[model samples]
Target: GRALSELDSGMNRVQAMRSYAGDQLNRADRLESDMKDQALTQEGARSRAEDIDMITALSQVETQKVGLQAALQSYAQMQKLSLFNYIG
Candidate 1:
C-alpha cells in the first residue's frame, strides 16, 4: 500500500509538471506572436521612412514606442494572471 501511495504521489507530480510546462509553452507562443506583430509594424515603418520626411519618421517612431509600451503592459498583465492561476 505504501509503495502504491508513493507511486501515485509521483505520478501526480509528473502530471502537474506537464501542466506547468504546457503553460510555459503557451506563454512563449503568445510572446512570439506579439513579437511578430511588432516586427511587422517596424518593417512597415522602415519602408515608409525611406520616402518620408524627418517629421513623419519621428511621428512613426513615437507611434512604435506607444505600441511597444502597450504590448509590454499587456504581457506583464498576462504573466501575472498566469502566475496567480498556477499558484492559487
Candidate 2:
C-alpha cells in the first residue's frame, strides 16, 4: 500500500513538471516570433535610409556641376572685356 501511494505521488509530480515545461516552451516561441518581426522592421528602415542618402548625394553633385558651369561662363565673358576700360 505504501508503494502504491509513492507511485501515485511520483506521477503527479511528473505531470506538474510537464505542464510547466510546456508553458515555458510557448513563451519562448512567442519571444522568437517578436524578435524576427523587429529585425525585419529595422532592416526595412535601414534600406530606405540608404536610398535617401544616395539620392541626396546625387542632388548635391548636380548642384556643384551647375555652379561650376556658371563660373566658367562668367570667366569666359570677362575675358572679352579690356581691363583699362573698367579702370577709367
Candidate 3:
C-alpha cells in the first residue's frame, strides 16, 4: 500500500509539471502573435513617413530643372554684356 501511494504522488507531480509546461507554451504563442502585430503596425507607419508621392516629387523636380535652365541662360546673357571683353 505504501508503494501504491507513492506512485500516485509521482503521477500528480508529473501532471503538475505538464500543466506548467502547457501554460508556458500558451504565453509564448501570445507573445509571438503580439510581436508580429507590432511589427506590421510599425512597418505601415514607416512607409507613410518615408515613401514619397511619385507624382508630386516628379513635378517639383521638373519645375526646378526648368528654373535652373532659365537662370543659366540669364547668366550667360549677362556675361556677354560685360565691358571687360572689349577692353582685353
Candidate 4:
C-alpha cells in the first residue's frame, strides 16, 4: 500500500506540471497574436498618413498650375494692348 501511494503521488505531480505548461503555452500564443494585431494596425495608420501627404502635395501642385496659367493669360492680354492702341 505504501508503494502504491508513492507511485500515485508522483503521477499527480507530473499531471500538475503538464497542466501548468499547457496554460503557459496558451498565454504565449495569445500574447503573440495581440502583438501581430498591433503591428498590422500601426502599418495601416502609417499607410494612411502617407496617402494623405501625397494627396495634399498633389492638390498644392494643381493650385500652383492654375495660378501660373492665369498669370500667363494676363500677360498676353497686356502685350496685345500696346501704347498706340491705348492712346488711339
Candidate 5:
C-alpha cells in the first residue's frame, strides 16, 4: 500500500510538470506572434515614409523645369533690351 501511494504521487508530479511545460510553450508562441505583428506594422510604416510616389515626384520635377525655362527666357529678353540701351 505504501509503494502504491508513492507511485501515485510520482505520477501526479509528472502531470504537473507536463502542464507547466505546455503553459510555457503557449506563452512563447503568443510572444512570437506578437513580435511578428509588430515587425510587419513597423515595416509598413517605414515603407510609407520612405517610398516616394513616382508620379507625384515626376510631376513636381516637370513643373520646376517649366518654371526654370520661363525664368531663363525672361532673363534673356531683359538682357537683350539692356544691351541695346545706354543710360547714365
Candidate 6:
C-alpha cells in the first residue's frame, strides 16, 4: 500500500511538471508574436518618415530649379543691354 501511494505521488508530480511546461511554451509563443508586431510597427513608421523626407527634398529641388532659371534669364537680358550699344 505504501509503495502504491509513493507511485501515485510521483505520477502527480510528473503531471504537474508537464502542465507547467505547456504553460511556458504558450507564453513563449505569445511573446514571439508580440515582438513581430512591434517590429512591423517600427518598420512602417520608418518607411513613412523616409517618404516624407523624400517629398520635402523633391520640393526644395523644384524651387531651386525655378530660381536658377530666373537668374539665367536676368543674366541674358543684362548681356543684351551692353555699354557699347548705349554709347555708340
> Each model's TM-score, in the order given?
0.57, 0.56, 0.58, 0.59, 0.58, 0.58
| lDDT over C-alpha atoms for residue 83 of model 3 | 88
Lowest summed lDDT window (length 10), candidate 3: 79-88
Each candidate: RMSD to true structure? 19.5, 15.1, 12.9, 17.3, 14.7, 15.9
Can you give the lDDT of residue 21 in candidate 1?
A: 100
Candidate 2, residue 15: CA error in Å?
Answer: 0.7
Give the winner by lDDT: 1 or 6: 6
Model 4: lDDT of residue 60: 94
Candidate 2 — which pairs collide? none
40: Cα error in model 5, Å: 0.4
lDDT of 4 by residue, 1-74 (tens): 99999999999999999999999999999999999999999999999877787778889999999999999999
| lDDT score, candidate 5, position 63 | 100
Please write out the lDDT profile of model 2 over residues 8-67, one tens digit for every residue. Answer: 999999999999999999999999999999999999999887778777888999999999
Global Cα lDDT for candidate 4: 0.96
Q: Roughly what TM-score does model 1 have, to 2 decimal places?
A: 0.57
1-88: candidate 5 lDDT, tens digit per residue: 9999999999999999999999999999999999999999999999986897989988999999999999999999888776447552
Could you tell me how far off, in angstroms, the CA of residue 88 lies in candidate 5 after the best superposition? 73
**Model 6 global lDDT (CA atoms, 0 to 1):** 0.96
lDDT of 3 by residue, 5-24 (tens): 99999999999999999999
Off by over 4 Å in 2: 53-88
Task: Enumerate residue pairs that collide in model 1.
Answer: none
TM-score of predicted model 6? 0.58
lDDT of model number 1: 0.94
Clashes of 5: 0
